[model samples]
Target: MSEMVSHSYPRVALIGECMIELQQHANGTLKQSFGGDTLNTAVYLSRLLGSAAQVDYVTALGDDSFSDAMCQVWTDEGIGLSRVQRLPGRLPGLYCIQTDASGERRFLYWRNEAAVRECFTTPAAEPVLAALPDYDVLYFSGITLAVLGETGRARLLSTLGDARDRGARVVFDNNYRPRLWRSVEQARQAYRAVMHEVDLALLTEEDEQALFDYSDGEQILQTYRAMGVSEVVVKRGAQSCLVSVDDRRYEVPAHTVQKVIDTTAAGDSFSAAYLARRLRGGSPKDAADAGHQLASLVIQHPGALIPRSVMPV
Candidate 1:
């Protein structure tokens, strides 16, 4: 297979939901915004790849003002919206974040009836599924699986198979949230099913430990290797990241952030930069370096998205 970055331009699609994000301040003020793990990655990926790749976000949204604003922001970031589904009468989910003095963040979610939960199950989803295979890359996270529910997940699995058969590479982010599923066993089953189709997996070590109870990095790496995933990157915050590709291993140290103002999208940003660099012809090590570089900058900001002016050159 050719290097992902070898193509002059490629089409990449990311699947997940974006919610209305509120940052609750110590003074009890709330700053309304929008963010989601996959959406965060999409924004950063589009920024990093520029015109070199066509980045699209695939999700269901309400035909409300919040959805309108979200679409506008995505367009401003150069992300394509052809794959987005706008459900009538429904609204996007909402979440609020509170950060401690140490800059650690906690979240409260209110997404049960979000339009994205019916994303792949609705009648309108059929055409979107049909067009997914045309992209060069298909990316989604574990949160996506949880929101899709069983029926949507089955449809997604079938769509993944067809996309893979069409030579589209599948990228997965292990953004596991236990509260999203009925039980750990159910989440495990869903993750296992999706893992089989993943070509590149960007995982956080702590999420692996929480989800699978895996003892250490070696076991996690071996499990992904067993799943036939050719490339895996284990992100360890504040420590070195581990990369496994074709039986070779590389340890790339993370860039240290002097003070983390907010760690909201650290992993998401890292995955975006890593994938963007790889798509731009950087080697695994170089890609990891890019991931760390971007993540380091992101943590200095107060939200999931930093200003465009502060973006690294």
Candidate 2:
């Protein structure tokens, strides 16, 4: 394999929403916080990359107090919010998580009216969409696409095409949620519309099976490769991750955990660390190792954003 090549201080824009997160404790108390698929990735990416690359979050939030707090947390994490839009008379969405004895999580959402749904619909979003092509990498997930609605998804697709034309890499994570879409066919159409423009795909094995009903791992890889994606990583919980770069493939085992306090953000942290390593000139194998390492530590914690102190050096 060739040595890793870094992009030298590249700009990354992660597009998604951050919601009010509540964790129901065993004592029947609720602990409030914030989390989202891409937002969790943004936070972990910022922590891993530090000042090496410019990491910005692109999403719309309400002018409410929760939005204010979320922005502050991002700022503290060294994630840029210059592209974050503050919509008026709107409120961010909320969700509560219930964990089973095995630390597996189930979420209940109240996000039909999230401010981020208008992220690309409002008049102010025009400039933001116009500016997206300026970044070196643009990252988003399935959840990000789901909340955008039809009009917003159309706008995002055009923006992605434009961005790729300007040499920006488009990264996508297949974080599928069946409840978010009207129909499976609708989701498939939306995914297919943008797949051709994707540069790197960070996919989960279960999500691929659940969404497209792929028979096995090979089918998933073949589908993405056929879409012209140059890089693909298939994450399987507690199993080895499969990586395909061009014509070559590699299997990197995940880090084992003794106990899992919570299973949330495992994939998000994995994607973040993987991207961070790649941007720093690490090989695909090294990046996958880093991903598994971070994810291992994350699942041992209670929340999405674990304390920075426990971070691996």
Candidate 3:
């Protein structure tokens, strides 16, 4: 495989929500931390890139202590926070995770009134939206679309178009949550609206099936190709990850894990590593390998983030 040309010190911005995360144990105890899909990717991407690139997170949060703690964590991880908005009299979302013995997870959320729902709709958001197009890369997920509501989604779509027009790459992760939308058709509409603006799509086979009722991976790839997406990666848990770049296809095998603990942030971490490797000029196969390796390590831990000391060298 040919290596992608490396870009110099790319500035990346990830847009989404970060919530107060609670890990519910079998003994009825709860462990509190902060996590969200885009935020998790931002943290991992910053750690992987270090001084090689700039990674920033764009979202709205309340002035609560939880929000304070979240900002501190992001700051310590080397993620830029110049675009974060603090809204008064509001709070971030909250979610509780329950993990099965096999490391599968179920989430219970109380986020309908989260401050991020107004992320791109607030009066203060005009400057943030105006600044997004200046970045080298913009990243967001299906959950971001769902949470943004109609007004916020419209603004985000416009910003994405402007970003692409200004020569920025737009990376999208199809992390679909059925309950987040009022109906399947609504979710499909929102997804299709943003698909055209996406440059690279990191998708899960299961999410594609559940969201679009596609029969197989080929259908998914064909659909993306038809939509003019330049590069696409399909991640299948414990199986090979399929990559389609410049009309060339490759399947990279996932690393084996003997024991699984928590599956939280598995795909998020994978996407981060894949993007980081690609930014460093790795081939698609090499990037997928990096993704699988990091995802394997992340699942062995208990939360969205593992201790920095255990990061692979």
Q: Each candidate: what lDDT?
A: 0.92, 0.91, 0.92
Extract clashing residue pairs from model 2.
none
TM-score of each: 0.97, 0.96, 0.96
The candidate that achieves the highest TM-score relative to the unseen native structure: 1
Kindly indicate the candidate among 1 and 2 with the higher TM-score.
1
TM-score computed on alpha carbons, candidate 3: 0.96
Candidate 1 has a TM-score of: 0.97
The sequence of per-residue lDDT tens digits that candidate 3 reaches over residues 145-248 is 99999999999999999998988899999999999999999999999999999989999999999999998788888899899988999999889998999869
Tens-place lDDT per residue, model 2, 1-313, is 2322235798999999899999897777999999999999999999998888889999999999999999999999999998999998899999998877775678899999999999999999989999999998999999999999999999999999999888888999999999999999999999889889898899999999999999877888888998898899999989999999988898999888888777789999999999888888888889999999999999998778889999988
Q: Global lDDT for candidate 2?
A: 0.91
Q: Model 1 off-target regions past 4 Å?
A: 100-104
Model 3: how far residue 199 lies from native, Å: 0.4
Off by over 4 Å in 3: 1-6, 99-105
Residue-level lDDT of model 1, residues 89-161, one tens digit each, is 9999999988788757798999999999999988999899999998889999999999999999999999999
TM-score of 2: 0.96
lDDT for 231 in candidate 3 is 91
lDDT at 78 for candidate 3? 99
